[model samples]
Every structure is written in C-alpha cells, then in structure tokens.
Target: MTTRFYRRTASVLLAAALAFNCAASFAYAYSAPNESDLDNHQTYRNHDGETVHSPAHSRSGEAPDGATARCRDGTWSFSRHRSGTCSRHGGVAAWR
Candidate 1:
C-alpha cells in the first residue's frame, strides 16, 4: 500500500508539472513580441508626422512594408487608425 501511494504521488506531480508547462507555453506563444524582436526601420509616420508602430516580426521572415500591426491570423496590417485594425483578422496579435 505504501508503494502504491508513492507511485500515485509521483504520477500526480508529473501530471501537474506537464499541465503547468503546457499552459505556460500556450500563453507565451500568443503574447506580443518584444520590441527588440522588431525591425526598427520598418516604421512609418502618419499624416500628423507622428511615428506609428511599425510591422514587427520574429526571425522567421520579414513583414510587409507599411504594416502597422501584426494580426492574430499571422498577417500584417497597414491601417492608419488603430480602432478597427485587424478586426477581421482574428484581432491584433501585436501592434507594430
């Protein structure tokens, strides 16, 4: 009975650890990219001459030019306004 208890405790601990790891991975995967991950030269200015968020991407590849945001669907946004940016593309994953 003692051996069975120990085995069950170990199994439970291992399962808990796996669950936590999976949750952490999922959260990190969907979070916004860091500023350092972006290409600073990709930024553009609006009509008011104010600098806007530029297209940001990981090392996977380059985002399109004039892109102002990265969509959750893995697309780039060129919207001049932020109100509805990426509304149709599963919402904005990260504002560029």
Candidate 2:
C-alpha cells in the first residue's frame, strides 16, 4: 500500500511538471511586443539580402514619439513602396 501511494504521488508530480512546461512554452511562442512598447531600433534584411543594422533615430540623442526605427535591407526607393528585396545575408535583421 505504501509503495502504491508513493507511485501515485510521483505520477501526479510528474504530470504537474509536464503541464507547467507546456504552458510556459506556449506563452513564449505567442509573446510579442505591444504597440506601446518603444522600439528605438530595429534590424531587418536589406535589398541586397545582407543583414544590416540601422542606427536609431533620436531627437536630441533620445528616442522621441515612440517611433521605433529599425534597420531594414534594401534601399528606400521613393518612387515605389514595398518593392524592396531582402538582404543578401538572408532575412535575419537585429538591432543592437
């Protein structure tokens, strides 16, 4: 009887741990920054398909208006919108 009780307790604990881990993973997967969260800098693939980091746009050396600036691959062609291609290094862009 004692051995059966111990086995049951251990099984319950294991199940609880598994549930917690699954919940944690799901939370992380769906996590994303909100609009209110300031993005002073961003990085993205450029037209040349190279990974590039863009400098933060700041007012008086400080981020203003919460306008998050991000580094993006490809030159900004004023004539066309959404015509830029990814950077040469693939689509990985990161901010400092």
> All candidates' lDDT scores?
0.62, 0.37
Error of 1 at 67 (Å): 0.4
What does the lDDT come to for candidate 2? 0.37
TM-score of each: 0.37, 0.30
Question: CA lDDT of 41 in candidate 1?
Answer: 36
**What digit string (tens of lDDT, one per residue) describes model 1 on residues 19-68?**
99876552111233345545543555655465555444445466654556
Q: What is the lDDT of residue 48 in candidate 2?
A: 45
The clash count for each model shown is 2, 16
The most accurate candidate by lDDT is 1
